[model samples]
Target: MIRSMTGYGKGEALSEQGRCTVEIRSVNHRYGEISVRMPRAFMALENEVKKALACTLKRGKIDAYVQWEEAGGCAALPAADLVLARGYAELLRSLSQELGLKEEPSLGLILAQKGVLGEAVAGQPDPDQCLAQLMSAVQGAVAAMDAMRRREGDALLCDLASRRGQVAQWVQRISERAPQVVDEYRQKLKIRLDQLLEGTEMDAARLAQEVALMADRCDVTEELVRLSSHFTQFDDALAADEPVGRKLDFLMQEMNREINTIGSKSSDAEVTSLVIRIKAEMEKMREQVQNVE
Candidate 1:
């Protein structure tokens, strides 16, 4: 079944290390693009995350957000700057001695000195464990998003099918009206000739030749046949189990081309009006195809 490019999904996984949550949002795009936002600790896994999304989602502008809530996670780990702490202790002891103070520098006092305690550079403690949890969460989120996209795709398919049928009906009407147009032209031409030749005989062979030429110029049989073939191809693509947005887009262009050709060749007002409506329907289908995958 086809899928739409717009959807949102969220998923999570838990492990002894932490709980990983992922949220994915996708929108229509001409090509595949996946962007991930996560803590600096998981930055190394950015490419892998993007690859996984692209592999499953195929085509779209996808944004993924990753959140790792450590059973006791910190934006950054608290660290004791041992070197700084030692220096502060030494300086305090020297000052106490110089002042002949009896009191020793309290551990807390030394520890609280400037830069004695600080935060460590953020980094993954266990990359393997993080990756496993992250991948699991990402997979779950992808599954959810896929389901939503499919549901939307079904709706899109119905609309496209209905429009296709409408266009086909209009094409049929145009086909039926084409012959009448030539016949009407022939009749009108004969009447004009008769009026001009008042009391004189008109050339029957010449009139038939003129009618034949007009019919040849206005024939839309081949265009209609090709358009019908495109419709079949469109249906086949829709039923296929793969990304067919580009294929459908191409087919719409082709169908539009044929319709334009027919419209240009047709002189009848009725056929022209039908062409206008078909073109309108084709435009709507093309817009809908842009959302399919």
Candidate 2:
């Protein structure tokens, strides 16, 4: 399915760690770019988030935001108390010497003493699990954006298809009118030559050769054939799965080249008018193609 390069989506997930929210915004861009914003605590997950988004979006200027809420189960980190530990160890040593005891207090017995160390009520969330949850939210957000982009692409495709069809019609009109132009020019040339040398001996073979050369110069058969071929390729690009904006733009240029050749080869007013209209429509299609992904 085709997808536009502009869209927005949001996703949220809840887990033992916290609530994770992901928001993504995208707009048309020639290359894929993703920028992520989140808390410092989750800064380590930026690369992972970008990689995850790359799996879905091929091209765009994507801005992603991640929000996290702490769960009640997590507790603050305990502050170590060096002063208290040293005081308790010193007091223990003094009591041992006064009691004539020779054994030294173990390191564990000092830490276990009251007021020496604080205990935690709950453990902090697992870094791995938190990252996993965040990714899940980000994936959901990308999926939502994909749906919106695809919907917008449907409209774009329909418009482009209609314009392509119109261009094809104009090319056909130019092709049919091209032959008549040379025939008309041949007659005009002969009349002009007769008027220039009235009652004088005119070389019939020379006139025929002149008319033949004019016809050859004005012929648009090759250009018409190439234009039709380009139309076929344009249709294929529309049906393609990957990004085709650049491809379509290139095809439009090729089509314009053929149209220009046809216009230059023929001096017919009708052909000029049709060529002008095709150019106008092609310009509009080009503007729309810029938004395609």
Candidate 3:
């Protein structure tokens, strides 16, 4: 199915140990580009996350953020630098004796001193478990992103289809009116010739030859047929399941070329107006195709 290049998704996982969250944001881009932000410990998982995202997303500028939180983990642990605390106490007592001070140091005074206690926590995270939880979060985010892309893609497809139908309708109208243009020109030419040759003998063969040549010069059958074929190809490309942005763009170029050729060859005002409308629709489709993936 067609996918849009813009979307947003978020995923979260919670366990007994901690909670993990992942958020992804994407925007239209010519090529796929992924940037990730996570804890230093989780940096090794960036490659895996990027690979997973690339598998699902073909083209976009994607940004991902990951965060982890541990509950009831750091508060219960006691400080580890008891030796530093004892050393501070011995020094304080010596200072008191040397100054002949009478006040005694309390636990609050010792705890308030710098380097008396350590705040660092000790524990190694399980790589396998962390990886599993991260993958789960990534999967959820991927699903959400895909849904948004699909929804936008559906709207785009509908609009494109409608425009295609309109162009096809214009092509039909042009085809019907094109032949009449040449016929009208021929009749006008014949009338002018008759007026110029009034009361004079004229060669019927020469007049017929001149009209035939003029008709050939005004013929747009080949261009119309080729334009119809291009329209068909464009429709086929739209219905395709894979990335069709490039193909649709190429088809539009061909369609525009055919329309220009027809407009230049056909001198009728009505045909020219129809060609203009087709060009307008083609321009809109071209803009939309840029966001498709």
Please tell me which predicted candidate would have the highest lDDT against the true structure: 1
Candidate 2 Cα deviation (angstroms), residue 244: 1.6
> lDDT per residue, candidate 3, 174-214, as tens digits?
98997798788778887888899996877888877887887
Ranking by lDDT: 1, 2, 3
1-293 in candidate 2: lDDT tens per residue? Answer: 46799999999989866788999999988889999998777888899999999998888899999887777735456665899999988999999999999989889989898877775323434556698798889989999999999899989999999999999888888878877887888889878988999979889999889989988988888998888888999899888877887888788889888888877887789999999999899999888888888
Whole-structure CA lDDT of model 2: 0.86
Give lDDT tens digits, candidate 1, residues 135-187.
Answer: 99999999999999999999998999899989999999998898999989999
Off by over 4 Å in 2: 72-126
Of the two candidates 1 and 3, the one with more favorable TM-score, higher being better, is 1
Note the residue pairs that clash in candidate 1.
none
TM-score, model 3 to reference = 0.78
